[model samples]
Target: MYGLIGKIQVVPGQRDALIAILLDGAREMPGCLSYVVAQDSTDPDAIWVTEVWDRQESHAASLTLPSVQQAMARGKPLIAGFSERCETVPVGGHGLATVP
Candidate 1:
């Protein structure tokens, strides 16, 4: 399984709008096992996004999806910067169905 964890900092007062865009784009992602958007506990302008996919290629392909592309275009102006991004290989986890 492939996973990504990213920290995004949005322009002040724009976090909720950005989060809404992300959530909308995440819906119906092919091969996506999980996708989560979280608010940073200590930073008002920071948000965390975590995703799990069946393959790295699927994750990459999602970038070209129309919804994702639209979200990127709409959210670009609200984004301040990215703080951290980490890629991972997930073995197993709760809520993720195990493949035989």
Candidate 2:
């Protein structure tokens, strides 16, 4: 399984706007097993996203999709910092498969 945690920092007051774009993605993107976006109470401009994908390939491919691309475009100007990490799990919790 593949799980990703992404932390994004936007230029002040931009988090809500960014989160709105991300929320739009949740409606139509494919191969997404789960997704959550949150605002950091300590840092209003900071946003956190956690996503679980059926496979790493689906998640990776999503980056190139128009929906995702558009979302990113809306967010580009707002971004100040970003960090992402991915993990693989065999069992016990949420797990993802390799791209087929």
Best candidate according to lDDT: 1
State the lDDT of candidate 2 residue by residue for 23-51, as single tens digits.
98666557776778999888777888888
lDDT of 1 by residue, 1-100 (tens): 8999999999999999999999998777788988899999999999999988999998898899999999999999999999999999988869874321
Whole-model alpha-carbon lDDT for candidate 1 = 0.90
Best by TM-score: 1
Local lDDT at 29 for model 1: 77
> In candidate 1, which residue pairs get closer than 3 Å at backbone N, Cα or C atoms, i.e. clash?
none
Tell me the TM-score of model 1: 0.93
TM-score of every candidate relative to the true structure: 0.93, 0.81
Distance (Å) between predicted and true CA of 34, model 2?
0.8
Model 2 lowest lDDT segment of ten: 90-99
